[model samples]
Target: MTHDPTDQYLPRGEFSFLSLSIGAMIRVLYYRLRGMRPVRVGHCKQCGACCRNLHLFHRGKWIQTRRQFKRMIAECPEYERFEIMDDPGMLLLFSCRFLSEDNICQDYENRPSACLEYPTLDLHLRSKVLYPNCGYSFKMVKDFGKTMKAVAHIQEQAEDKEDADE
Candidate 1:
C-alpha cells in the first residue's frame, strides 16, 4: 500500500468513555473465545507515522516522548500503558526512542510493555492514546463490529437484571 506522509501527524478524534467501556467488554469476549493468540509480527514499513502521531497519557497527563515516558514511569511506576495489559508485558506507544526516520524500534526484542501488544483489537481502542495517526482504529472498528454488538447485548442483560431486581 502507498504511504501517506500527511497521515503521520494528523489529529485523530479522541476516544469516548463509552467507546472504551465497550472496547473492554469486547476484549473480555475475545479472551473468552480465543486464548491469547500468538501475535503475528510484521515489519512496520518505517512510515514514521506512528512516532510522529501519538496521544499518550501518563501520570494524569498526556505525553509523547521517551523523556516524558521515563518521568511518567518514575512518578507512577505501577501504571501500565494499557497496551501491555495482555500477555508479555511491553509498552505499546506510537513513538519510541529507537524509532529512526524510517519508524523502526531500535530495541525490538526488549521494547516497552506497549510495543509488545500492537495490532490487538483492544490495543486499537487505546490507539487514541498511542498512535492516533495509524489506520488501525478504523480497521478495528470495522472488524470488531460484532464484538461491539455483543457488548451492547451484555449491557442490556445487566440492565434487565437490575430492573428485575427492582
Candidate 2:
C-alpha cells in the first residue's frame, strides 16, 4: 500500500526519523519490562482495534482481510490486493478484512503473510512515523528501536565483509 503525502494523518519528512527513534525506544522499554509475562505486550485484546481502524492507502491497494482472502482461490494469488504500503521511508496503513467484530482474525492460522507479520516493531516504528491513537503504539515503538539496533549491527557486519573483500 502506498500513502499520499497529502494524507491528513501521514507523517512528513524528518518527522519520520524522529518517530522511528521514539518507537524504537518504546519497544526496548516494553521488552525490558514485559520479560517473562505470559501475555505479550502491544498485542490486540481481540478488540479488533486494528481492523476497525483500517484505512486503505492512496492506491487501490489495501491490507487483505479474511473476507478478501476467501474470495481468492489460492493463498498466494496472482494479483495480491494488498501491498506493503510505505511512504518512501516508512510503512503506513494496511487494513484487514477477516477481522471479526471483536477484532480477532477468524482464520488466523491461514492468514496471509502480511497478517502474519503484523505489529512488527521495526515496521511499526518505521511506518507509524507519528504515533497513531492505538494503545499499542508505545510498546511497538520500543520494539522497533531494539529491532533497528539489531538491523544496524547486521548491516555493519555486511559492510565489514565487503571492506575485507576489497
Candidate 3:
C-alpha cells in the first residue's frame, strides 16, 4: 500500500469546528464512550515540560521548532509581529521564556487560557499526551463516576526502557 503523508494531516470534508482531525477524532470517541476526563496529579511539580515543549497551533498542526516557527512567520507576514508571551531567558533556556529561574511561570496569574488549561484536551484533541515529568493523569470512568482506568502516565514505556538500558 502507498501512503501520502500530506493527505494524513489535511482535514477532509467541510472545514468547521465540529470536524476534527483523524487522530483527535479517535481520541474524542474513546473518551466520550469511556467518560474520560482530565485528572491532574496532585500539586504542580513545576517540571516545565509544557513550557519547554512549547507548542503553537498553526496550519492544522503544532509549531514546535524555532525554524518551523520562523517559516510560519515568513508565510504569514502578519505574524511577523506575533506577540511575545515568554521572558528573555527562554532564548537561552530553550524552554519557556515565561519560566522563572526556579521553573515557575513568571506571569502565572496572568497566563493565557492555554497555559491555564495545561494538558486539558482541546475541542479537536483528546489524547492524554503529557510531558515526560508532568504531574497529570486522565481518569476514565463508566457506570456514573465509577473509575475504570486511573493511570498516572509518565514518560512513554520506550523512553523508560531506554533510560534503563543506559
Candidate 4:
C-alpha cells in the first residue's frame, strides 16, 4: 500500500500547518479545493438568528438590507415575504417571513443555500460576526509567523519614526 502523506501532518483527525506552510502544498491545495471543514458537527438551536439579517446575492453583489433586496428582486415569486428591521451593526437585519415564533423554519425543506451555510466561519472569522447563544463553532488556525512578521515590521517602522523625532 502507498503511504498517505497527510498521515504525517494529520494524526487521528488532527491537522497542523495544513495551510500557512509551503511545506504542505498538497494539503493546502486539498483543503482549498474542499473548502473549510468543521472540527465538530453543529446543530442549529432554532434561534432564528440565521433567518434574520439575510444578505441576498443579487447581480454578483451582496445586498444587505431587505428593502433594497426586495426592490432588486421584485419580479421573483419568492420575494413576496420579508421584514425591514434594525440590527446591531452596520448591516441591516431582514427577518424571513417564513420563520416561525419558536425559531423553527416553516419552509425547512425549501430553504435556500445561504440558509444551509449559516454561521460560516470562513465568512465571519475576521469580522467576529455571529448571533448570540449560537451552538455552532469552528476551529481556525491563523498563520503566526506571517502575523508576527507584519506586527514586527509595523513596530520597527514606528520605532524608526520615534528615533528620528528624538
Residue 82 error, candidate 2, Å: 5.9
For candidate 2, which ten residues in a row score worst on lDDT? Answer: 10-19
Considering summed lDDT, which 10 consecutive residues are worst modelled in model 1? 80-89
Residues 35-117 of candidate 3 have per-residue lDDT tens digits of: 65333333346676666555455565655556666787687653343344553433311244566566666665455434544
Each model's lDDT: 0.44, 0.42, 0.48, 0.52
Per-residue lDDT tens digits for candidate 4, residues 36-141, read 4334224556666767655444443445665666666575546455565675445555668887776666776556545654543333432445566555555544
What is candidate 3's TM-score against the reference?
Answer: 0.46
Candidate 4 regions exceeding 4 Å error are 1-41, 65-68, 71-76, 87-90, 141-166
Instruction: Give the candidate number with the greatest TM-score.
Output: 4
Structural similarity to truth (TM-score) of each candidate:
0.35, 0.34, 0.46, 0.49
Question: Judged by TM-score relative to the true structure, which candidate is superior, 1 or 3?
Answer: 3
In the range 97-163, model 2's lDDT, one tens digit per residue, is 5555655565554554444333434445445432354433332223445567779999999999999
- Which residue segments of model 1 deviate by more than 4 Å? 1-23, 26-43, 57-72, 75-94, 126-166
Alpha-carbon shift of residue 85 in model 2 (angstroms): 13
For candidate 3, the clash count comes to 1
* Between candidates 1 and 4, the lDDT winner: 4
Give the CA lDDT, 0 to 100, for residue 120 in model 2: 37
